[model samples]
Target: MAASTAQNTTGATGRTTTNTTIRRDTRTLPAAALGPENPLPPLLPRNDPHRVSEEQRATLPAEMARQIGYAPLTTVLPTRIRDGYTRERVPTAVDVIVIENDRLRATVLPGYGGRVHSLLHKPTGRELLYTNPVLQPADFALNGAWFSGGIEWNIGATGHTTLSCAPVHAAVVPAPDGGPMLRLWEWERLRDTPFQVDLWLPEGSDFLHAGVRIRNPHETTVPVYWWSNTAVPETEGTRVLVPAEQTWHFGYQRGLRLIPTPRWEGTDHSFPLRGTYPADHFYEVPAAARKWIAALDETGTGLVQTSTGALRGRKLFVWGAGPGGRRWQRWLTEPGSAGYAEIQAGLARTQLEHVPLPAGAELSWVEAYGPLSADPAATHGPDWARARAEAEERLTEALPAAELDAAHAAWLPHADLAPTETLHAGSGWGALEVASGGHELPGTPFDPGTLGSEQRPWLELLDAGRFPEPAAGAVPGPSLVSPAWRDRLECAPGGPLTDYHLGVAQWHAGDRAQARRSWERSVAAAPSPWPLRCLAVADGCEGHLDAAAERAGRALDLALDAAAPAAPAAALAALAREAVPALLAAGRAAEAGRALDRLPAAIRAAGRFRLLESRVLLAQGRQDAARAVFEAGFEVADLREGDEALTETWAALTDDPLPEHYEFRMRPS
Candidate 1:
């Protein structure tokens, strides 16, 4: 790493400051220093017979092999290099760095997920961000264990990206405005992408500004997701304010649904108004030049998060005051761990929507988290925004005009310094669209009444049975399984979907016995519909018609019974395609007919589903009906001629047999 320092003098304020190299050092503290701990066993060495790879068996040290099933093989862990582990209170050390100005101070844990662990308001002696009292790990991350609190940068594929729990490279750089800045970054191996975030605390400022950059270093375009997650203490009157027109809900048993925010009667879902069931949902804030979200406590003091550049979405997740929430708190922290709510912002409109990062392209953005003054009487959406704006204006007026202009140019060049666009008072479900340009300043004549309808045209098209043709490429086949896929499966487990991928890898490797075992374990563990559908495909390939029908029926039943916030529209279509064929082959023609008839019209109209319908019709000795269905599908959209499983299954049904294997895209966890 290289070091750089600079000094600049401000003429207006007659103040001089020097930007020095970011200082990094190590500090030792008690292992339980952050919080209490009902420490679970070390996360490795679970007795899963299928987990022992040939490489591990061949290269294991004698000592490691002896404790393979009893203790964690710390040295072989993918992310962290653990010095040691203890069940009781023990001394632990981590790399720490600090960046501060006159009014605010931030502590960065470079070795522990590069988390901004502590943000303090020097004048008030208040910790503006929630600080976890203990450094405990829990099974919350995609790779099994993660620590809570602080602002975690989630990149790559969802659910706390791989780097969330791992150490990242850090450095101190002088901000363009001559302020102290801390930069931390890591290369994500799975996506072949590199991401970096610069944390800048300008002199005498209360806000901590973060600039993020993500680059796709691969030759091909890839799907990517980015979110900044911050945990804040939740008090009785804690409220979350998001400047969005509508909200979308997705979770276990909750099918995809849209609703109005803040004004939901009986229960104000906008904030922690009343504690009932656990509420975990994502809200899509239409793209606006001035994007902001905040969480305030009873005393009116809280954190306000604003972003510029490519980030466009915001999410609020609260573990309610129920038993499940309590259990989750225990799992994530020690005995005295306070209940906290997460305020998250993302790069896309919704988590389910994948944003494409073109090859060799980069995305850049800035997000600022600052202290918000309390307004005890401000409870509604408009009131909260008003109070926040006033506080922001006070800070702006206190800074030198030149420095303010330079700072605005540095992070928000495209956005004008203005109050957010006016929001409509009326409520209704509508298509959540991204805003076209930057937020308009207040007092500028603008219409708040007719922003737009809530109905989404793209969603309406999907509902109308029109799907865009698949991208031009051979649908990835099982035969194309590579070493990278195997490594990913090995590194990430504990999810039914990951298990399904493992089964797919095993099947492709010519190991049916292990494949079946893996699939069975997957369903036993989570019962998500994906693995069941895969098992049905395997049974069909083996000519076990009766067993195939049974599995396929179960898959359909589970999917249909799910209270999915949004229909797993694509997944359901795939399931219908597989189940119809199996049901027909098992001599259950009536059941097969019912299965096809029950599919949503929009789904049944899809090219893939129509193909499956045609196959079922042909199997029932109705060639004319099958031909009509096939032609109708083509009329809807020109079918992309790929999908090895569909092609092979159609061939086998037509007495034109091909090699047998299951194929599906891996879903992000």
Candidate 2:
């Protein structure tokens, strides 16, 4: 088989037939280039200044990073195993079998990316689990191929949607001594497909591991979030335990509890699932964890669910200590009343093992999965310390040290749950909602957050300040914006980057003092390129153009160096140029000149600054000379581009006779 790719899910044909493995270019975006703007919006608002308002200063809950308790749970293999064959590093995608001394066997299938038309389950030996029906892929929303994106999808793909579950590997590991061993096949295929798993107790073993391996073909990497959509009839009873801070209360709203990240650091928060909820997609677990859900029941079903980590890093177990709701979740035939406990662990970074390497140069992540369970809640009894110990011990003894190290190394890329820096490689975030509409944001940024179902790209944007929200205008009163990257901030006592935009918002709303304060807090707390820009905006709006220019110049450098969007920085630069004379008149010519020259040549050419330059130059008695620069340089171009082609929202407000400016109306990149 020549190195290439093929998707069984029919859409359109004509894929490249070459066998050359496509490697992701490590070229950091010149602006950390992700996509060459494919089609960067030709026109953007010219409003860079954020005028503060009283509403901007509205106090909100401060969220912090460490509150959610995000730590990678590591399991090093037991050192007692023999050398060579038994202790050799277990490569991913290899099939191995475990033969028990007491007479039991388990098969391991790693990285087998295909459909299992014939369902197969073990242990219990009732092929019914896999034989009932060929659970074909669904075509509706609650789950469907409705929201999809790839360069081709953008070009001309019908429906433009589909859930992606890319498979990674499968490992058939034996249980400690002679217990219920497992055949763990980790795959990431979108819109979950069911399989037949066999559970063999082998007379003496008390535990087993259920594993599923998937295949991902989509260009974008998404967290494998398929729960047991089909509810097992609990004529006996069933329960799913999920960790959460406050059990999702209120109402079932959209068949799922939509939890907002406290602030945009990274969803690093978690608590026990409390109260009642009939969830379809209960988003109780924070972004910190995406796979590894647990299910158990009063009748003795202690099942631990989980997935493999992708680029986002870290796998999770979705349950904690709590019993706030009913004993079991509503069956699929009924409503899903409980939530799943899971974690978002990063995936292995090496692509040397993939069959047909994916396109694009960004880091991609897919989840690995398995189901660990127990039964008769009372059978184990109080503390159930013995049972817990047995399970833990089996899980520990299941692997040899070499294999664990190899797997651990593969997963190192996503080890840091709290990634404070942007990806030097490919990093993308798209809005997560599956919109029923067509092409929004046209030629601008890919906005997945506003669309509704947040993908990693959207989260990255919010964390990186690409969306620049009032994410859906906030909730008013106290809360504002959904918390995706909430726990990564300095929030609670105050968070990083929180006040920077708020200051700009208040500044834009004309709340100078609050803007100043927010700006101060923004810089002091995190000191990003934003704080300087916020300070500049505050100064310019307050008629302290001289100070504004100083702040603006510094901010631009930071934004440019970070490969961040330049619209805001550009707007600030243009505004500072206009404020030169105000500085000179205030006897600050030295600093004012420096600010003017500091503006990059490209931004100065945008034209908004010429208006102020006209005033500044004329005041310096170089009226003719000033007129020449304004007319030949700035004004003429402004006239050609027209007053409407500005990137900053407050551009018109700046002496540039442009028009009303607002960043929201501009397309997001």
Candidate 3:
């Protein structure tokens, strides 16, 4: 009976009969690690004077507590207060798992987020993916630590995913085709979900196969966002190809807007052209059957990413060649290193879109990353599409139906798998052991808004060292705020504007003393009203009414003197709003009235400034006028307003004792 079954079917092409083998090696290398001993620090100080008071927390709703991951007005919020990875590169050892066959070699860093550190095409000895020179971490992750380069598997919530910087269970398995494979598994604590990725380099194949599975372990439904971010060398002629006719553009502050792809006029946003401005757009890949995206350089040598399962979203995120782009490169990598662009694929149509996994449900798919040869000049829309189709055909041929199905079945019993054999440092070849852990890694405990807005013109201005002047008849940029601004300041410090921005970030982070110090430094460098106004706000928050009044008076004078076309009206409005409170606190009701009178009508009508007006009227012993101001402000923009700026203003005015909500801001924290 066994002999009869062994008989081959005519021209079935089910499995490979040829002798092929793959090698797996593991080594310990010096790298940074983040865990309980070294936890990430809070972005803001806990003792910040501006923090919501205990009295305020008591009045807030329970929902707000759940949203912020803590009770309202609590002094000690249940934040994920872990120290970040140390910058001092120590001799801390890390496990490096290498899997290779005749055609390709791939390295996996199991100790560092289980990322595919490098993928190389053996035939050409060319790296198929961008490899970071160092294993450095930045405060860009939703949990407050992110690293650039290579391929990062983002699962759970948005941003870089909670596990991007954490270690995952990894192991080596025997491929059905007789090649070696590496598998990584991570249990997401936040969502009570478990996920795994099985990677292999089949013999005689140029592509690396990644089998991904995400399972819901809970009884209730779970919402999830999964994306694979692959970085490649971006150059003047590097072009990204995704078969999409139109794209959705989502900016830092700018919401969703649609634009045609391949070309966007004057911009020529076609992947081959050199992008002058930063772009973070998502293109919908309606090609439900087979999805593919790639990035090719001028040399016609590049890499392609294709998925055999559902792929609703394709993304191209590039830090343009402009000053802002350059600064971000410096921030994410070591200096003098070339910046790279990202070609990403997701299960949803957009980054903000998520899917709900039913109880006991599981979703599985396969993705391929391979090298491509093409005519660089001809690798546009149709040309790239043809190349993708050919690549898919090749992959299908290499991974036949019988062999692929067997491999899928092996991965389904994730927990029953044996431990990966560990290879000691300098061992000829080995693999890292991976197994499911009892718990998920610690992630950010606070609400998403704690990270702040990514799109701040003030930050770009500080990085560019020049104000962003609008074109004739164009509206000026929006006002600058704290939030993620501190992360930017850390990258490039020393300038007057940078210091001023730093002060704002510090103030928001609850470090009034540091905020004052930064503002003082800014005043010394450029003597601008911006720094003085920020200083006044800090002083008032600290209960230094007299000092606040003096600073506010000087700030008001400087703002009036510096008022010009280039000056940001938003800054002027900020000064007026802050000065009135300081003057009122210092028992200078008349002075507060004068400051209120000088404010523009538009500023007075603004919700935040209206709160200031009410404060000014109250200090003048006119309680009725203050109430009227609050009533009118609420009538125009209620506490439930959708706009973040207005909602923050409402929180400040009502002293709602609840944390400000900015959940509307998209992920990638």
Candidate 4:
């Protein structure tokens, strides 16, 4: 952690300022590698029930209607599930980009989705964010594999960004107010857009400024989502303040209700520890109010996040004081670690909505993060209005709203400045997109030279109008579901691989019937398991459970037979996961058991398979065996956010209350 520090008197405005240094460093932590992704494609669409009621929808403004759940993802195709991480932890060195001034230090992890891993205030030597002790990947992001802590830029969909564990291009650029700025940019695949984040620390400022811009290069309107999620250490005395008397409460029960902001259910909901279950409190900030949110402790000193007017919404997410909430805290990191809550800012009122970016248009906003301190008694007082006023007064004093607006205007010109140095490289998809569409993104260049193996096939298809086939027994490559690529794929020479990818692209476009026909043609050309499993999904979606089971079983058998002896276990596990559930749905419990047994012993030992095994055992009337599976204590690495299967299965097996370790229920029943 040692590094050299020096003073450089240079400013973006040509005025001399205090000392500031921008350098690279490494941190050693107990980390687990994000292993290979699931080979099986996600055929089913994201079916999270995140819709608002008719009455609530009617009350929303016209712009809200355009954004609410627009262009829902049919599938997370191009991005695969990253469920390969395990509980085993080993010390590893992680690269970090540090930008520090005389008053503060901001450590950025460009390799980890450009996460602001730590923000330290120099005067107090206090960390402003909840910096995680270990790097543990969990199934939290939109495409799985997310770590908890620091500040994360959530984009693309409602959930965490697909690039949570992926790398992003980083470089040094000129800061608006002075010194060097750290810029991170990447191509967001779900919306087919490119976005950039510039981090600037003025010479002597406590606040870390982030300039964000998302551009839709296509001719058609695109639904865009952006949220800056900051994790702060939570304690019983911590209180969150937003300038709103009412808030939207959304629990895991798939319902959203407007309730009083601070006091709800005769308890102070502003305190993260007051609730009994995990929940989201989206503050209903007034249109005229300055948009900001702060998490202050009893002593009235903590992190505050504020943005320009365009970034309108603010929220607080807490894994509450309940047993399940406490258990989740331990599951994400190491045991006995301090709990944390998320204070977030977003474009829409709720994460369930997306804002529409018009054709060939872009949206830009500036967010400032720093430490806030106010009178302890007033901030933690019984009077909610006084507490909020104290926070607002302190925030304005630290960083004025007008100052933030001026900063945005000043940074606009520098946003397009070319990078002086490239620190890290992200995915080649952005370059591939530029290669195909010929986009002219100036500052955030997706250099064609960065294209690698993953983009080679798509590049070939773009150049030759044919998707190249992989070697025998090799898992299918990544998918491209954009309209232009789909059109090229449609005209490509018909083959097993080409037809299979075309079916996926068609499915993403919502043409189910055509997708089915394409998959059938793919199977007819070459009877491979990939297309067969896809057909299984189609059957299940169509409510042909028996046919789905049969297809899944056939697909599983083919995959096992064709797999090499040393093939990655994930390849087999992917098919087995789909087949087992389908078999159970078709009431073929015995067949499910046989299918589960076919997997290697180690794969079956994983948490997901063990849960499936419990279901299979219960179906066979072996209640004791099912209970044993739960008692063995397996962790579902890819357990979805709102999935209640764990608790539901526990209830079905016995009358006993669900075990604390398995209690991830976010809703109060």
Candidate 5:
């Protein structure tokens, strides 16, 4: 789908400019299809175990302390893991919306979580952001399927986002500067909040202005997290500058510490390539200082991002110069792609904390993206203060703080205007929220026309007073764990399906006993594998390792049985992955081997399965066979950030140094 709208602007010389355009188009790139999401329910808790130092925690104000770590996710229920994507790349067409003026062009991917795919400076023919050559999905996202590069809007917890591989609604609207604006809006599931991003390029202006708004329509306060992460090309001389003397450093060791800026560990860490490992630096910008961060190249010309006062924090994340970091970089995209670093702005001082948003209230801010030019000597100088001052002055000259404030004021009223034309359609979940809660969101409407199959059961529960059960062997729908949904599920008549979903909701609410009873009733009513799997998770959470292993094995067998086709092969493989680990934990190595042998040839041939195969082999005392698994060159696309399982497994196999392909350690030993 393609549509265009142009605005004519009269300049000071009484000349009319007629080429300010906002249009929708398509771009074909070498991309991998993000296949289906895992069908099984998330039975375990998904708490963030990242540690913070006492020094870091002591510095937090009262309000920040109260809001930090609030509403930790019990499970990623209702959202599923997207592990079906492989490393295979083919030419695929992706939807893009271009917001352009005479000076710059901002191309956005609405179907891919409203990511700013490319920011081009028209005058210099330069791409300001790190535009990836291929769209390869990786396991960096909270719900899986994340690609590197460009600017991404992360709204859920401390990972990439649940919507990293999903879509959002997009439309064309009027900009505050009388030009056309491209609007992207979605209902964030994790926080149950509605948010919108408005992108526009002022006529002949150098900056691309973005106005962001997040609303909490509930009667109670909600924990909110928002970060705009921008990826920029990193080179030997590229330096990141922010007006700060100190920072909070968080490494993969899972500890945060206060450290001096620019120079650390006998090297200037602002140059990303100088570091030996991946890490995060949350710059402690003073309250009165200008809120801006800039990344300048060797010539002192690159991108600068400046926002209003509401967006308070700035951070720099580097992949570093280590081979493990390099392997991760190559894994995310093409091996030959230029290295990149992330400069991020968030509401909290660090991504580990979440701020509180009052009920019936909204938070809004304006950000400007444009080119910055400074003296190479000053920006790359040994004096950190001098480099920061130079960058700040250049940013002020490019886009004044007062002008950005004025832009925010001008955009407040326009943010409530209805979208003029729809460009793309997203999921039906937002409309279901609107229909259930009767939320009066004005500008970003959740039209009933957008509802689809994923939301049908919940819609029936809302309208018909019963949760409709699907036919046997049909794929299960997502689980809703909110209080309102729980109340509805509890009030409905009990059955196999109702009891199963009710158990999930109860478990998320921390009512373990009731959840167990509900699942037991579900199994009694219908002896299926899902509820039994839930019981296994409960058993594992407690210390009943034997019972957990037995239940897990049963679930795997039932899921894979031809008579009971409850889940797809991908979901069955996920079940096997979990069950084999449980069996190994219970000292049932021979049973784990038997389970692996029972799997279909194609399912057992996956990369993740190959890693599991090595684990099973090691448990069976077959060290040689286990070593061959790593030598076969398999990649675990879904390997988590802090997971050291691969390294531990390899160490057990041999005493030699870990190989480069298997080395993904982000921290020092």
Candidate 6:
């Protein structure tokens, strides 16, 4: 059987065919007995961030549209049709509603182009499909895409939730090879809630396909965590393995990689988990797979969990490493592998990793799994190496590097500005006053507040050139919400703000024109805080750098929010300083100036990470202040002895901040 190439259906792992179009009960088109081709004109490319089409959701059918008094799927593609769900189920919040096939008309399996939400599968293995809908986190502490390892009590009947399926914007492009390919159109206009989708694997075909419409219909972002539940059969006798760079081991050689803490738990990778009592739990998977397979070392029960999902890489426990397994079953009954299951709390994407997709952009996570052993040909050799690399490339879109860059730079556009109106409204000079013509200081960075008692003593100390001392206080520390809450609300990493962060992927990978359009999509998807700050900066860069900043900033914020020790204040200092220059370059001088004035002077005196504070000093233009800043904090002694980007930036500005070795070490020199 040929697997679907996404290029077309012919030669796809299975022999497949799309039967003649079935007219909707509503579209009285008896006369228009549609030919093999679609009657509608091809849709425009969906690039608008404000529209659902761009988010890539399948639309409602003509019948459902008429019933609802509005047409759908007009903007999306690979429509849903037929009446009454030919399948059924009941989906309470935690449980899934399965929709099975009675007439064999439905085709949705991992490989059938179903676009399942998890990361692993077989039966075509192209994409994973799910019967679960999107879930949200009502509380900041919990993951939105929650999962339950309890046995599925009832795969209910009567189609749990009624659905309106129709053709979406994606069109089927016929390849020259005579195989049919799908080319999605009008993706920007088809937005709405993501619904529960099911799978139906035919005995012979290589492809099964389905899609969803995750829309942000409002001007605001729609926060969500999608969960997937699959029923992978359980076998026996096989071992289990969790993939990750650092793993914790437990019973029977079971391994897991978790966030290390003072007191750690779970089986780690380096250790072996050998036991016979039933065992199941959660653990971290490696960040890189290189298409590597964490096999169970048997004929039928060797695969435990795999990385494979279209938008999100899935984590599964296979009966022999079944599909998308969660905490319940990672081992089979016989000894080969175990049953497979999909577990995710929507803490993020494909798995429980907490990945978010900005409003207008698409975030895809790809992973692949099949049979393998240490036998070189399949396990440690060319074939294994080749497939592993290929799989890695598939999910690279969601890799931490690029998105991390975007998220870190998310709030960058307003870094240089003071948070209050006083410092900014009075001087248009912004950071220029502090760093003009190589005369800026080399102090670490700091943001000032409204000048309160809390910051008063520190300011005095900073003015006197004594830094970082204020933070030595016993009670209120980095965990304390900076008493400096001056109406600064940013997007929580996976929250509504910075919803446009996902747009970077499209821009980065698309063509020039596509990139520019995606840039607009990026801006449009950003949170309100970003645009407000950008307006505080300038409008031009708002679409590019500012957009990038919003993504990066939100990611950084999420990281900070999820951070173990949870220090918002330290993150603030770091996030703000990095944001300053970008905001300045973006031309939001006023905003930049406002933020600059907010730096706590104490950070200035340390001269170590003093760039933030030094920025303010340079602004004061007290040559002594500027020089003092240049001389403070973070002893990267070899590199001007500082652990501050601002210091590095300042040294680069001051030429001799350490000249002789300057060009040799500092970048951007």
Per-residue alpha-carbon lDDT of candidate 1 for residues 539-584, written as tens digits (9 for 90 to 100): 8778889999999988876776676343355456556756787898
Number of clashes in every candidate structure? 22, 140, 9, 1, 0, 182
lDDT of predicted model 1: 0.56
The 10-residue segment of model 4 with minimum total lDDT is 2-11
lDDT of 4 by residue, 1-669 (tens): 534333464546786546676777899989988888887777775546456666676666666655664776767777887878887889999989898887889998888899999999989999999999999998788787899999999989888999999999988887875567889999999899899999988655689999999999999999899999999999999999999999988887766778997998899999999999899998899999999999999899999999999999999999998888887788888977889999999998888888789999999999999999999899899999999999999999999999999999989998999987788899999999999999999899998889999899999999998999887667788888888999999999998899999998998888989999999998998898888999999999999999999999999888877746434688788889899999999999999999999888999999999999999999999999999998888988778776789989999999998888788877786
**Model 3: per-residue Cα lDDT over 1-669, one tens digit each:** 011011111111245423233233444433445533111112232221112344543443443222222312211111232233444445544556676665777877775567888998887899988887766665555444567889988876545665666666655544445334566765554454667777765546677888887776555777777889999988777777666767766555334556877667656565632665556667856654457777887666688887755555788887666544564566555667877998998877566555778877778877778887765445643454564455445445545434544555644443234434432211100010011112221111111121222233443444464434333322222223323335556566476656765665565566778878988987897676667766776677678899989898888767666634434455556456567767877999899888777766865666556666766676677777765665553322111111234334334455544222222222222
lDDT of 6 by residue, 126-234 (tens): 2222222321111001100112121110101101111111121122222212233222211121122222221222222222222222323233343333333333322
Off by over 4 Å in 5: 9-18, 46-49, 53-65, 564-566
Error of 5 at 448 (Å): 0.9
Candidate 2 structure quality by residue, lDDT tens digits, 6-35: 111111122222111111111111110011
Estimate the TM-score of every prediction: 0.53, 0.26, 0.54, 0.97, 0.97, 0.26
Per-residue error at 473 for model 5, in Å?
2.2
What's model 3's TM-score? 0.54
Count of clashing pairs, candidate 4: 1
Instruction: Give RMSD (Å) of candidate 6 vs. truth.
Output: 26.2
Ranking by lDDT: 4, 5, 3, 1, 2, 6
Instruction: Name the best candidate (by lDDT).
Output: 4
Please provide, for model 5 over 134-230, each residue's C-alpha lDDT reduced to its tens digit, 9 standing for 90 to 100. 9999877877788999999999777688898899999877777665678999999888999999998766678989999999999999888999999
The weakest ten consecutive residues by lDDT in model 2 span 147-156
- Angstrom error of the Cα, residue 96, model 4: value is 1.0
Residue 548 of model 1: what lDDT? 90
TM-score of 4: 0.97
Predictions in order: lDDT: 0.56, 0.29, 0.57, 0.88, 0.87, 0.27
Off by over 4 Å in 3: 1-93, 380-416, 420-669
